[model samples]
Target: MMVNDPNLFWFGCVLWLVIIWLIVSLRHSNKVDSPTESNTAGAREIEELRQECLRLREELQMQSKQLKTDFQNATFSQLQTLLNNYPSVRKMTEAKPDLPAKNLVSLFTSLDNLLASWGYEQIGSAWEQVPYNPQLHQPDTNDIAEGELVYIRFVGYREGSRILSPAKVSRTLPISSPSK
Candidate 1:
């Protein structure tokens, strides 16, 4: 129209250049910031992984403690009868200030029950005079050789094929005599 308006044509060219420059600059800024964005994402992921590891460790510790408690319960629960009578034993002693030896039968019975519950067998009766087998008897003196007659002071205990405690043996029997 009217000689194409030379001033308007120059203005249009400048505006187009500005628009192109803005587009290129915006794309360059985004490209430059891309690595920083990725680094931030990587840091966040690492923190999340650390948190998960801590959670797993805590869970494992809890399970270990629980298993320990369960094992202890299982081990002690074998002597349920003895545990049940333990309180009564204390009360019996308290009730009788002058408690005689024979009145302590309850205590002995509890001990026997405890040993039986653990699958143990008594090696010898108290004051039992038997020919010594070194495997089953522990003599008071080293001079007392095997196959000699010895008396049991306190009965020993054994489990299946394994000896827990060998019978305590002496050369002479006690005055109380053997109580089979």
Candidate 2:
């Protein structure tokens, strides 16, 4: 083999330097690219976290609404039960003097609140003494007055405009004098 020329040797050295420089620069570039890739992944994770939070909030709202609906239904059902038990309660009151009237009144007021919560209310005029109307009064005829309603025996109830029950009334009657 011929001995290498000086110019050729110098060119070879220069070529080797260029190749080394390219290799080192490529390694550094790869290092920088990895951090950028990791940052992009981190950003994607944050976006996913945000989406999950939104989904949870929506679920909470739906559950809250459902709870409110269930509560209202339960309250209405309680009111219906209280109203249906009224006849039996009145009979018990007649049999037992020890049963407190105040306690019974408080229970009725609680029932009124329950009704009001579900958009029903005790009839206001039911408390006031009024003339007997066949349309408004349903009497058992056991308790008789004379001509018109002497008193409202129990409170009437309604839901909006629809009457739940007519007022139980006693009619006024003329007292006959003993024959002289």
Candidate 3:
């Protein structure tokens, strides 16, 4: 009967692989030990091929790293204008004057969508009240205690399980009173 059992199937594969390995190893050793000029030439060719493979592998790795750095630089350059306007954004959150907040909001929504596509997510919404968790929130003052209720003064971001920034938490909201 054919060894159709899954365990036997795997064992059979291992057994065949070991046998093939042994045969190849014996042949390779015999070739290396041969005193013939042709054997020496073949051995030199194999060494050269192995060295080329290593050199190519290292070059590929360097190119990959450079590409990654170039991508990061490009992203930062594109986002520089948005980053420069952060002070205005922070002020808008605090004492919002009769400015074009609607346009700013639309821009922020688009930015949020962009960040979401890049696997970044907001840790907490601006002015959102939540129980204090030191791991996720950075207190504004030393007076703040763990497990206490706090309002997020500034929203933070993260990618997967890694926190990019902790939400800036304060005892009071910067704007009009937020109901508990």
Candidate 4:
């Protein structure tokens, strides 16, 4: 049947308008909800990545500390062994007073090699012909004179810029003339 009446035509137009408005509103709501949902998911992903980065940093710090501890332990053990053997080496040299100079040289070369491997060096000079400096040497007696080194009581050692030990020494004094 044809809708020839004015009232009926107006009702049909109103119904179609309501349907189009409902469709547009539903699409708009979906578009708005989609971004909100996607944003929430994005925020969760970003937080997870941040937590992972923090965990990795902590692990690296732990590994670095462990490596330092291990290195210190190894160095300590090596030094302990060297110190333990030092007395025997000294005794052997003292007992063999007539030992060849070349043999003594070889023995000192081996000792130097050992010290070098541990990042250490002998600090005192063999022939103390130079003037004594308070920074490098500790005077054994108060009467130690200025020029010549009389004797070395103990040898010193150095590691980099640090003085591990001081050289213990006695200096020669000029003899005083007897009054006539």
Model 2: residues with Cα > 4 Å off, grouped in runs: 1-33, 84-103, 115-180
Colliding residue pairs in candidate 2 = 145-171, 145-172, 145-173, 146-171, 146-172, 146-173, 147-172
Q: How does model 2 fare in lDDT? A: 0.56
Cα lDDT computed for each candidate against the true fold: 0.64, 0.56, 0.66, 0.56
Clashes of each: 0, 7, 0, 0
lDDT of 3: 0.66
- Write down the worst ten-residue block by lDDT for model 2: 171-180
Q: Tens digits of per-residue lDDT for model 4 on 1-180?
A: 774755446645765665576556556665777877756655665566557656755765687678765774466456644443343345344555564532544455566676677676655543234466666666777676666555443556666776656566665422321122
State the lDDT of candidate 1 residue by residue for 1-180, as single tens digits.
464645446645765665576556556656776877756655665566567656755765687678765764565557444443443344444445466633665556766675676676777766567989888888888989788889776666676877756777899854434233
Alpha carbon deviation, residue 141, candidate 1 (Å): 0.7
* Candidate 2 per-residue C-alpha lDDT over 1-180 given as tens digits, one digit per residue, 9 for 90 to 100: 874545446645765665576556556666776877756655665566557656755765687678876886666556555564453354445455467752574457566566667676543232245766554556658545445654444545566676666666654311321122
State in Å the error of residue 134, model 2. 18
* Model 2 vs. true fold: TM: 0.39
Which residue pairs clash within candidate 3? none
For residue 142, give model 4's deviation from the true position in Å. Answer: 2.9
Give the Cα RMSD of candidate 1. Answer: 24.8
Ranking, lDDT, top scorer first: 3, 1, 4, 2
